[model samples]
Target: MDNIAGFIFLCGLVLVSATQPQDEILNNFQQVTKLSHLGLEFADFFQNVTLSDISLADSRAPNEEDLLCLRDLTLFSNALKERKLWALKMIDAWGSIPSGILTGNRHNLGNYDECLNINKDISQGVTIRGKYCFLQTSLSAMLGSDIGALGVVTRIKTATCFPASCSAAHMNLFVSQVLQKVLNLDIPSTAMGISDASCQTSASEPWDGLTIFTVVLLSLMGAIVAVFTVYDYFFCKNHNELPAIVKAFSARANSRALFRIVENTSNPNVISCLNGIRCMSLFWVVFSHEYTGRFFAANLNLFNVLPWSKLPFASFILHGFFSVDSFFFLGGLLLALIALRTMDRTKGKLNVPLMYLHRLIRIVPILAVAILVYTKLMTVVANGPLLQGFSGETACETGWYWTLLFVNNYTNVKCLGHTWYLSVDMQLFIISPVLLIALYKWGKKAAAGIFVLIVLLSGCLFATMMVNNYSMMFFQNSFSIDAMSNMYFATHTHATPWLIGFLFGYFLHLNKGKKFQLSWISVWSGWILCLAMIFTSIFALYPSTQSNTPPLTTLEESFYYTLTRVGWPLALCWVVFACMQGYGGMANSFLSSPLWQPLSRLSYSIYMWHLFIQEMNAKSSRTNSYFSDYQLMLQFWSDIGITLVVAYLLYLIIEAPIGGLDNFLRPQKKPAGVQKTSSYPIQIVSDQKVHGDGPSKLKETETIAQTISE
Candidate 1:
C-alpha cells in the first residue's frame, strides 16, 4: 500500500510538472472535464465546474438539458494537454516561439502538419471565438441565442490558409473528419485549433493547369461562335457584306429588331397579366436571394436575422422555396398550353425528339457560355476566399458534365449549382410530352387519371416526411443542407408543383377563349378564395413569430410545408385562370402591361447572372456583417441594379445570339394548314429549378421564326 501510494504521488507530481505552473489552463481543462461528466455525476462534479472566462451574472446558467448534453467525453481536456505539450516541443525545436503565432489570436496547428494523413503543406490556424459559442448561446437561448453563436462560427470561417494541391478548407475538413473517426469523439479538429487549422497562408494560382486549359479552350470557342454568328446575322442579310462587330451589338441597328423580337415573343392574344405575374415572381426571387446571402457563410451575423427566418408565416423573405413552385406551375402551364396547341396543329401527332431538342437548344448555348464565364473568365478577374479555392467556383473546374446533363442535383456535384433547375425542367419537359400526349390522345379522363395519381403520390411523399419528422426549414438550420440538397431539391419531391400546373394548363387549353357566364357571387367567391389561398400560404407561419408560441409538432410542420407548396401554386393558377377569363380587372392590366415587358424580357438572363455577381461580392470584401432591413434592402437593390446591367450584357453576347439565329437563319415554313408552334426564346429562365440546385421558375417562350401577330 505504501509503494502504490508512492507511485500515485509520483504520477501527480509528473502531471503537475507537465501542465507547467499555469493554474489557468489546467483549471479550464478541469472545467471541460466537469462539463463532460455533468449529466452522469452532476452533484459530484458541480463544484469543480467553471466556465473558463465566462461568468455572466446577467446571463442565466445553461438549462438542465443543455448542461446535460452528450458531450465529447473529455474531448477538450486531452486536447488542451496535447496542444500544451506540442507547444513545448515546438519551443524546444525552434529555441523560441513558432512563426506567425505571435504567441496568439490565431492558434497554430503546424505541429499537427500530418496528423490526419492529410499531407497538408499549409500553416493552419484556428480562431478562438467559437470555443465560447456554446456557452454564450446557451446563456442567451430565450432571447435570441442565434446571434453571437452564428457570428462566431461565420467569423471563424474567414480564417483560411492558402495551400498547394489541397486548399486549407479541404485540409481542415479532412483533419476534423479523420481525427473524429480516430478519436471516437464527435469533435472538430479545426475548431480545436490543432491539425490543419491555419493562421498561416501561401498564395495559390487558380489559373494554373486545368484552369488555364479550360480558359484557353473557352476563349477559342467563344471566338468561333462569335465569328459564325456574325456571318449568319449580318452576312446573311447582305450576302457579300463584311460583318461589323460594332453593328452586331449596336442598339440602333437592333432596336427595331429588339422591339420586333419583344413583340414577337409577347403573347398579346393572352391577357398581359401573365407577363406581369412572371416579372413580379422573378424579381421577388432575385430579391429573396440577395437577402439570404449572409446565411451561406459562418462569419456573418446570421442569427441576428433568425427572427425573420423564424417568423413562420410573415417570413416572406425566407419563403423563397414556395416562389419556386410558382415557376413549376408556370412551366407546367406553359408546357401544357404549348404542347396542346402543337398537338392540335399536328392532328394528334406528338414529336418527342423535336420537343426535347427545342427545349435543349433554347437553353444550352447560353447556359454553356455562362458556365464558361464562371469557370474561366470569372477566375481571371476574381479571386477571394470564397472564389479562389474555397467557393463552389472550384467545383466547375471538373463538374461540367453533371451540370450540362442537368443531373447535378441528383449527382450532388453541381457545376453551376443554379442550373439544376434547367436539368429538372428539361427532365420534366421530356416526361411531360408523354403525359400530355396521353391526355391529348385520350381526352379528359386520361388527364384526370394522371393528375389523380400525381396528387396521391405527392401526398404519400409528404406523409412519409411527416412520419419521419423531417424538418421543413432547410435554410434555417446549419445541418439542413444535406437533406435540402438531396430530397427537397430533387425532381421527385417537387413534382407536385409541375403536376398541378399541368392540370391548370390542360384546363386552360380545353377552355381556350370560351366565354363563361358567372353570377356576381361566383366571381367574388373565386377572387376571395384565390386571395385567401395566396395569403394563407404565405402568412401561415406568422403565429411562430411570438417566442411564446408553442413549437410546431412534426405532423403540423409537415402539413404546413406540403400545403404551402400546393396552395401557393394553386392560388397562382386561379389568378391566371381568372385573369384569362377577364375577371382580373385592374390586376390583369397591371400584370400584362408593357412596363413588365422589359423586365420579363430580361428575367431569364438576370437569373443566370445574379448568382455569379453575388459570389464575387461575397468573397472580394471582408467586413463585420450585420443584419437589418436597411442592410438587406441596400444589398437587394444594389444586387438588382448590378445584376440587371450584367444580365443585359450577357443577353447581348450569349443569350441574344440563339434567338437571333433562330429568327434570322432558320427557314420559316408556313405549313399548309397550321401556324408554327410557339417557341420560347430562352437561354436560361427562373432561379426556381436551377438556383443552388434547389429551385428556380420559368418564363413563356415563342419560337423565333414565327412572329407574333396576336
Candidate 2:
C-alpha cells in the first residue's frame, strides 16, 4: 500500500511537471493577444496615425520588442518556433487585433456596425483612408460547449481595421498564424485557414473574369429579349411572316399562354386535385426552407429555436423534408400516366429520345439560369458579414457541371443543395420508360416484378442505415452530409416512393372512366386510414426530439425510415385515387378548385427560386436575427410574395417561351377523320386491349399535358 501511494504521487508529479511548459507557452500567447494590451497599443498608434502615414507607400512596421516577445513566447519548443517563425513575423508586422476579439460572445455576433463606426470616427480629423475587413474563421465550434457542439456558432464573424498597406492576403495570413501558433495543434488545412475569398475588405473590388463573363452573358440575353419583344409586337401580331425563333421568344404571346387557364370539364380522366397538391407542397417547401435559413443564420437566440422543435405543432416544420417526396410521387405519376397513354396511342412506338430531350428542355434552361445567378451574381448584389459563408459560390463554381448533368447527388459539392431533388427526379425519369414499356407489353406481371424490386431497394436502404448508424430524424444533432447523400439524396433510396406513384398511375389508368359504388362507411374508413398514415409518417419521430427520450436504436431508425418512405406515398396514393373516382366528396371540391391553377403553373419556378431568395434575405442581414414562429412566418410570406413575382417573370421570359417552342417543334398531327372539339393542342386516341381481353375504347381526347406540366 505504501509503494502504490508513492507511485501514484510520483506519476501526478511527472504529469504536472510536463504540463508546466505548455501552460507557460499558452499564458504568454494570451498575454500577447489579450484585448487590454492590444487596445492600449492601438490607442497609442492612433494618436500618431494618419492617412498618409498608413498609406501603402509608408505603413507602420512592427516594433522590435513585439517581434522579440513572439519569438521568446515560442522558444520553449524549438521545432514549433523554427517552423512558425515566418508566420509570427508576418503577423506581428501586418496584423491588428480583431474587433471581435473584444466585443463578440458565444450568443451574439460582434457589433459589425460599431466596428465600422469606430473606423469612421477615427478618420474624422484626417483624410479617411483606412480599410475595414471582415475576417471569417471556420473554427468557432472549437470553443467547446453545447452551443459550439450544436454548430449554432459554427463560424466566427470578426472585423478588423487595418491600414491600406495591409492587404487582404496579409490579414488572412495573420489570422491563420495566430490560430495555428496559439492552438499549438496541427489543425486540418481546410478547417483553420481563412481564405482570401472569405475576407471582405472595404476596398472596392475589381470585376474578375467570371463576373465579367456573367455581365456579358446577361447583357446579350437582355439585348435578345429587347429585340425579340419589339419584333414580336410589330411583326408577329400583324400576321406578318416570322421565323420560329422570333415566335418562340415573343413575350406578348407567351404571357397570353401563361395566364390562360383551361378547365377540362369533359376530360373525367384528368386528375384535378393534383394542382392543389402541387401548390400546397411547394408552399410547404418554402416554409421549411425559411426555417432552415433562420437555423443557419447568425441567430441571437438559437437555443430558443431548439425548444420549438420539441413542440408538437412544430412537427410540420421538423418533418417537412417529406414535402420533397411529394414531388417524387407526382413526377412518377405524371411520367407513367403520360408515357403509358402515348405508348397505347403509338402501339408501343414511343419516341424515347425525343421524350428525354423534351424533359431536359423543360427543366434544364431555368435550372441553368438559376445556377448562374447564384454563382456569379449573388455576391455582386449582396454584401454582409454572413454572405460568403452561405453563398455556396465555391461549390457552385466547382461542381455546377455535375448539377447541370443531373448527377450531383453523388458529388460532394452541394451547390444549391436543394436541387438534389431534381437529380433524383431526372434519374428516375431516365429509367421510367423501361418500366412503362414492360408494363405495356406484360401488364400485371411486370408490375408485380417492379413491386418486388421496390422492396429490395428498401432493403438496401435499411442495410445502408444500419451500416452507417443514421438517425431517422433529419434535424437531429447527429445528422450529417453522409446520411443525406446516402439516403435522402440518393435515387435508389427514393425509388420506392416514386415507383409507388408509378403503380398508382398504372392503377388510375386501368380504371379511368370507371365508377365504383361503395358504402358510406367504407369510403369514410378509407379516408380515415389515409389521413392516419400521413399523420403518422410526419409525427412518429417527434419523441426523438425530446430531451427526456432516449435515442432510437439502429433497428428502430431503419424500420421507421424504410416504412415512412413507403407509407407517405401510399397515403397520397389514396387521396389521388379517391379524388379521381368521385369518392373524395368535399376534399375533391377543395382540391379541384380553379384557385390553385395559377399558383400550380408557377410551382416549378417557385421551387427553383425560393431558396435563392431565402439565401439572399438571410445573408443580407447586417446583424443577428431573433428566431421566432412569428418572425419565420413573416419571412416566409415575404419570400413567397417575392418568389411569386420572380416566378411569373421567369415563366414569361424562359419557361413559357420554351414550352411554346417545344409544342411548335413537336406539333401533334390531327387524325384525318377526327373533328377538333376543343382549343387544346395535343390529343391522344386510346384503344387498347386490357389483360388480353377484347379491345377497350375511349373517345379520342386532349391529353392532360397541362395537368402533368404542373
Using all chains and alpha carbons, the TM-scores for the candidates as numbered come to 0.67, 0.76
lDDT of 1 by residue, 1-710 (tens): 12212212222332244556678645634433332211112212222344342221114564432232212112223333455432222222211111111111111122222221222211244211111000011112222334543333222221221122233333344334433433343433322331232222233345667567656755664575566656566556652352444344433333333433233223423545666777777767776777666554423344455565665523677666666787777777766765676567657676565555555666787777777777766746654333435356668866887878878868766787767777777678768767877888898888888778777856866776766667665433422555566457678777888888888878877877677877879889988998898877777766755578776666777788777767777888878877766787888767756566566666777888887787777644433344566776787787788888988766665555554454443345576666444332121121122222223544234551122111
Backbone clash numbers for all candidates listed:
30, 0
The numbered model that scores best in TM-score is 2
State the C-alpha lDDT per candidate.
Answer: 0.53, 0.61
TM-score of candidate 2 relative to the true fold: 0.76
Residue pairs with clashing backbones, model 2: none
Give the per-residue lDDT digits (tens) of candidate 2, residues 378-438: 8787766567645578899889998899898788886777777677777887887799889
Ten contiguous residues minimizing lDDT sum, candidate 1: 128-137
Question: Where does model 1 exceed 4 Å of error?
Answer: 1-189, 192-269, 296-300, 311-314, 474-482, 662-667, 671-673, 676-701, 704-710
